[model samples]
Target: MILITGATGHIGSVVLEQLLRKLPAHQLAALVRDEIKAAHLQAQGITIRVGDYRDPASLERAMQGISKVLLVSGGGDEDGLQQHYNVVDAAKKAGVRCLAYTSRALQNPATLTNQLMVRHFQTEDYIRASGLSYLLFRNILYMDTLPQFVGPQVFEKGIQLPAGQGRVAFALRRDMGEAIANVLADDSCQNRIFTFTGAATYSFTDVAQALSELSGRPVEYTPIEEQEFMSRLRAQGLPAVAVERITGFLTDIKNDQESTVTAELADWLGRPPTPLREGIKEIFKV
Candidate 1:
């Protein structure tokens, strides 16, 4: 059976949905923390197994008789890496033959300046050391999060960030989920690392222009210093941790770390990935 962790989450839920279309219900299992959210899947005849990454015993039980497993990355600073390690150890102990993890598309996993990437790199290392066949999906930033970064303030205040002349190849979460499902269904993806990115890369200026065109309102891109960016977020009443995380992304953008464009996503999806303007329109419901 193919077991997917974080099956109720944004990406994982879409992955499970796509898998259901390709694989039989009995051949698929979902590791979900909330039985209520998973009731629909369970009703569809899928094996809904309760598991928490923080609970190794639960993972062990969930992985029983499973051949392939998708290790969805955990959230937050606390217990993120630890939970990943727990899942890796439990998967190995349960005799899972193949493992796949959703990782970030970084130039170098090692020597990460972003703490988030640090945790991901550490998990990649641990998974590699487990001696199991694995697929590391290095994904670009999600296009779905564009509005979150730009925000409603962008309509009036324009787009503000520390990034200057930096571009990002932002792919949609739904597209990434589909590509992941396709990878797991095909046996050729074993022991491979794939970097998934959008066909076109865009700078924040380009995003501002796109938003302006789509909304029929002027939007401008304003570049600020790193310190100013953090201060502004704090002034906007964001939590300290939230400010730090946002600043990390802005730092990565300013460094042009996420600007790389790849064709792997299109190849996997058998179509061109969504364009920035199109994705923005969908997000804004325009």
Candidate 2:
């Protein structure tokens, strides 16, 4: 049986849904913290196991009788890496043969300099040291979140950021979930690192053009200084961590770290991913 952690999350929820179409219900289980949110999944005949990465016993119990696990990386905290460690250790103790992890795409200097990326890299290192067969999914930025980073003023104020002429190969979250499901079901992905990304790369200016075409407005890409961007985001009452994570993405893009496009996602899904324009329509409902 395969257990999917973070089963109620943006990626895991869809991953579970897609996996059900291919694997039997008896062959799948979801590790979720909220039973109420997971009721629908249980109704679909999937096994629901209450667990949290911070709770090792819960993870151990969830891993019982599970042969493989998809360890979706945690978020929203500085101590998130510790939570991931708890899951990895519990999975090792549970004797899970194959463990697949969701990691960020590798940057060009192979450096984990970004605070957020550093935490993910630390988790990857710990997973490698756990001695379990593993598949490291180095996922690129999700296009679904492009609107969020573009802020609430993209139509009227255009796409403003500190990213200057940098590009990102943003894939849809649902498509990535499908690829992760395929990885969990296939043994061939074991002990491999898959760099999952969209087939095409786009700069912030290109994103502005796409928005202009979709919204029938004069959307522009405005580049600002890093401090000014942070100050503006902070003025909007966003938390420091949230500001850092959002701006970190633009910083990485500015440095040309997230521009790599790959065919692996298409290879896994047997189809082309959703185009940026289509994804924008879906997210903005325009």
- TM-scores of all models? 0.96, 0.95
Tens-digit per-residue lDDT, 1-286, candidate 2: 9899889889999899899989999899999999899998899999999998889999999999988999999886767889999999999999988888898875663643356777777888899998988999999989988877887877888877999888888899999999889877775645898889988988888888888888788889988888899999999898987888778767888987887788999999999988788887888877
* TM-score, model 2 to reference: 0.95
What's the lDDT for all of these models?
A: 0.89, 0.86
C-alpha lDDT (0 to 100) for residue 25 of candidate 2:
96
Clashing pairs in 2: none
Off by over 4 Å in 1: none
